[model samples]
Target: MKEITFYLDFVSPYAWLAFERLPQALEGLSYHLRYRPVLLGALLKQHTNPGPAGIAPKRAWTYRHVSWLGHSLGVGLDMPARHPFPPLPLLRLALECSGDGFVNRFVAGTILRHVWQGGADALDPARLDALRAALADQLRQDEDAPERAKRLLRENTEAAAAGGVFGVPAFEVEGRLFWGLDSLPMLRACLDGDAWFDQHWERAASVPQGLGG
Candidate 1:
């Protein structure tokens, strides 16, 4: 089976939405999903991404798109009135659990729901402590396992930065990067052996915009 690495930050609503949808989307594809926990600040600095909502034009349209997407996908997403802070801790845990496929999926899906739907403060230390406790019970982890989980979260974020991951909801298939949740379909297509590399890598005509006539 082919492998697809998914880089995500728990703080991103788009990442949360993508996390829940990827499994169903890739069910037919012969691929393994590898989770990478990354730092948003690093990617934003490199790409010069304006902020969480994106630049003016894109940001203006994104809310409607997100609302429409939620309705279509049947995914409940509660976007905060203000930009939610980064979900670094939760993302760290995801990265560390990448090797444990089942556990990673559980954490990814559950935690995203916890924040997006449950309205839990995903960044709170006590909330994470509760999550670890519950997870340990479900996973049959022994006493004090929550500490280990926290450690895992820390290690994964560090590894994510080292792996050239700059943003959340980024996908890497065979070492190629496809950023954003919208790219998942294409990523899955490549994993299914459709050989989409040329489509993404080939240099295309650049349409100049933002120029005053």
Candidate 2:
């Protein structure tokens, strides 16, 4: 079975949606899903891509689209008051509880649910402390766990950037990067060896002067 690396950050509602639906989508498929934590802000800065919330039009459309997607997927997704919340603490927690795949999924799901579904503040220190306490038994039991987790997050972000990942809810299958939550179907097609799955896009120097050009 091939391994699919799912690079995510909790700040992204799209990532939350992907987390909710991916397991069901991948059922009966011969692919292993690996969760990786990366800083979306850093990725944006490094790639010079404007964030969804930073643009007024995109932000308005994103909320509506995400809500519609949630309904389609039968998953509850309520955008928190703080849309672009700080994801560092949650990312660190995921790293601290990283050994077991199930545990990692649980931790990531819990954090995502709290922020997206529960309407809780993702950056609230109290909320983070409560979550950490809830998973105390599962997290790393070292005094330096926080530091170790931070380091791991940095390494993961650097590795992801090096591997051509520039966004959240991205997937990598056999070294091919499929970005965005909408790319899940394409990723699945690639994994299934579908003949129609073409990863290439033709590039042109200038727009054709036919209709709107």
List, residue by residue over 47-105, the lDDT tens digit for candidate 2: 88889888999999999999899988899998886877678878888788864322367
How close is every model to the real structure, measured as TM-score?
A: 0.71, 0.88
Q: Candidate 1 — which residues are off by over 4 angstroms? A: 53-64, 80-82, 92-103, 124-126, 137-164, 195-200, 205-213
- Candidate 1 global Cα RMSD: 4.8
Question: Distance from true position, residue 210, model 2, in Å?
Answer: 14
On the 0 to 100 scale, the lDDT of residue 43 in model 1 is 64
RMSD for all candidates, in order, please. 4.8, 3.7
lDDT minimum window of 10 residues, candidate 1: 94-103
Model 2 weakest 10-residue run by lDDT = 197-206
Q: Per-residue lDDT of 141-195 in model 1, one digit per residue for the tens? A: 3554446655555555566666666677888777767777788887777776675
Give the Cα error of residue 147 in candidate 1, in Å. 9.7
lDDT of each model, Cα atoms only? 0.65, 0.81
